[model samples]
Target: MGAQHDKMEVGDLKQEANRASPVNIIVSPDGMMYDYLNLPGRVIINEEVGASGESLSTRKPVKIEKLYEYVSALRSNSFKFLLREYEELCEISPQCPQTVGLSEINQSKNRYGNIVPFDHSRVRLKPMMGKESDYINANFIPGYKNARAYIASQAPLPMTVNDHWRMIWQQRICIIVMITGLVERGRRKCELYWPKPGFPIKYGLVEVTNIKEEVRLDYLVRILRVKIGREKSPKSRHPILIHCSAGVGRTGTYVAIDRLIQEIQAKHRNVDIFNTVYDIRKSRSMMVQTVRQYMFIYDFHLDAWQIEGDPEGFKNRKMVERQKELDSKYKELTSKDDLMVEQKATYDLYELFLMAACCCCPFLFDKN
Candidate 1:
């Protein structure tokens, strides 16, 4: 009886061991460990498992590679998504004017023939007319023996009211003014400080940062605030032209922040930021490119002090830290190499990972 009992106990122990063994170490499509069998004296394997357990660790390296590939794929998918959003936005925005013509005025009977009046309230034009004798009397005709001769000499180029209007409109008045750099020409003119000669108009330079440094962020905020002063007021007519190298990621981010501020001030709910940015990109092709930029919009929304003592402060700080860590890691991985090489490798790796991820699971890359 004791021998039979011992045989039964051994069988039970074997069954327990079988239950405890890891079930093929199921790894997620993203290369993360999903579960581990709970058994006594059973060896557990993970990504940190080294080469010594190579036979038993069929999954670790494969999972790590999959993880890298998955990240790359995610980045590529994000870029593609941004491109699609930009294309859609561009379809809904205004386009720049294509042509201007002014060559037919000399031969026309009417002085202002075919010339359209400036419809904008800010501009005006006037014409003048004088007789041939008046022109001769004023000594306006050159190289003439007498008044009549002078009058006849100037007859070919008939001076009319239309001619005077065209001259005044085209030559006497300056419509467009160009200023160099961030300082506006008008602002320079109004202030006591004299601007250097030939200073060009300045456009805002868009900058990207995962960690929001107070000084830089404050400067950007101040700039936007100054530009958007007393919304729709006549004091500021200048459009704030802002661009980064490609005029997308950073540019879109600033615009998003600006829009968010406005929405919050207006006390509007249901602010669809993605749609707002999408609308902007419709007019501006290179709007938002990077996932970091997209994520920045979320950060901007959450970090904004719309309400005093918002409880999200702690959560936002944690997210910000995570973002900084991710950015640092990405920078480290892609850094220490030539820019062209890095971009190409990053892009290629991203594509491959995306392909692999999509193959593994359809919805793996669709999480917001």
Candidate 2:
């Protein structure tokens, strides 16, 4: 009897083990390199993903890359699931503005003109808003909580250089992002739009003063001062203008990154990069052009958590959606003619009591 009991116990243990999760390892890549996470043994690349395994590090507001991984872990599927979710969402999303002509105001500069901001989202240059002038291919993409709102535009050409500055002045812009180099792969990408350090440049009524330039391995950040040199009242919206060769690839990527960074900072483990990008693309269809660029946002956030151990509004949204489904199901169950007929006597008595009670205590029922 003891031997047989031991054998049964061993069989039960094996069955439970079989039911456990098979993904003992998690892998995440940040464009250049990969980080592996081991769950069963608590060893990732021979080092702990987080040394303490608690939210020990008190990083300020948190960074996007790290925040993404923290939330991914909370979802229990890791970073891979996040990337797959984004890819599937984008793949299923319908490509809008089906006709190419609907997006383009100028046909010469852009090939297959990536839409000039949607009419509702377009930033009209004050100088050309009502005047007879070609449109500046630029858009204002609003981010979550109004964080990192941006105006994405193409690299200004020689003829449209003044128009680009006009858009900046009209929008009271502050930052100018030049993602593509002046010349890339022996091709002229964008005209030098900013003024030389000490020498201020003029374009129509706008004056561009290069205030600061911070260089990085991936991209450049330049602070620009655009003054109409005529407005009486002060407006505090210094909208950022981002541009690449065609204002589609790097331009969109940078814009999306800014929004993600701000959202992760604001919401911590609650924000969704996929939905954020989707919102931007709704306004400017070409934002975050490639799957690789989209994946990079996930990688960027994952890497932010690499140095230290880290920490779901996303799950709550899903819960709310599921609640809606349950509500509909309940409505169907209660409103069916068969159910009403089957329980008419009991339900009618209950309704009578409810109505009488409501009449007796008016405050118990909603007035509005």
Candidate 3:
């Protein structure tokens, strides 16, 4: 009875913590649930559902009403695409790059150390002193053709917290997108890297002031303005560093959404989410980690993007226009949070738990 009572008490607390705020209000699609990623709520699928594949003969844009259908097609076609992109893509080994003073496998987040960042796009932190390989296990991923991409990294351990801030300061980051907590299930996911709101915190050469902090049901978005004195400022741009427990599932998922929205703003509206994931994995070995995470990209993209075409000269202009009016969003309205997605969802009408190949293949059924 004690354990049972404890469970009930915990459930009640989650409900209270997740109670809807004005920020939680959202609209979703029919037969779909509310925004699970951005909104605070839960939906459990009682049973699995499937959809018959439709012939997709052309790359021409589909009607906005058929956005979900388009997503299904892209999903069904993902496996074959993976097979084709296998050589230059896919995870091989979990090994971190060897640096001075660190053990061959030290500071690695996982047993095999399989998901290391690529050399070409790795973020090199400014060393504290002397001679030690300033490695913190982070990757510098390039965004789509035009959008400024982010640094996807694992949660900072207690020791590496200083190096993490050093990287942020060296890079002149404008936004910090943290997807996991300091701890989860009695294990440490990330350290307390920043000061609480209304307090000034200094990490290494970087001085951080929390501009604003907004709590979301699915994640926490903090607007931060960081300054690094006596260092070269490349450009005062919005460079985001997204981190989570493992730094694959949630980190990759958020970056994918932001990049896709950038493409949408550029009028390249018909998005191939699979290709985007493939491109991201090129920089970080095991990005968009799980089958569930891949499906999440679909949910977020469908919810955020509309099929309607913007007028000529509308490149990335929607953001500037929406910022003045979108007060509920807190930060700039240029993120995935502003889009309309189903606020509640349970089981995937499409398969979710299967491996990448199986889940991405065609799901055949009566289409007539």
Q: What is the TM-score of each candidate against the true structure?
A: 0.30, 0.55, 0.57
lDDT of 1: 0.28
Ranking by lDDT: 3, 2, 1
What's the lDDT for residue 265 in model 2?
A: 49
- In order of listing, the candidates' clash counts read 11, 5, 14
Give all candidates' CA lDDT scores: 0.28, 0.48, 0.48
Of candidates 3 and 2, the better by TM-score: 3
Candidate 3 CA-lDDT value: 0.48
Candidate 1 residues lying further than 4 Å off, grouped into runs, are 1-234, 265-269, 305-309, 312-323, 329-368
All models, RMSD in angstroms: 28.0, 23.5, 15.2
What's model 2's lDDT at 56? 21
> What is candidate 1's lDDT per residue for 263-365, written digit by digit as tens?
5435433334556555454333334444334444543343333222244324345534644554554443223323333233223322322333322221111
After superposition, which runs of candidate 3 have C-alpha atoms over 4 Å from their true positions? 1-66, 72-112, 146-148, 210-235, 306-368
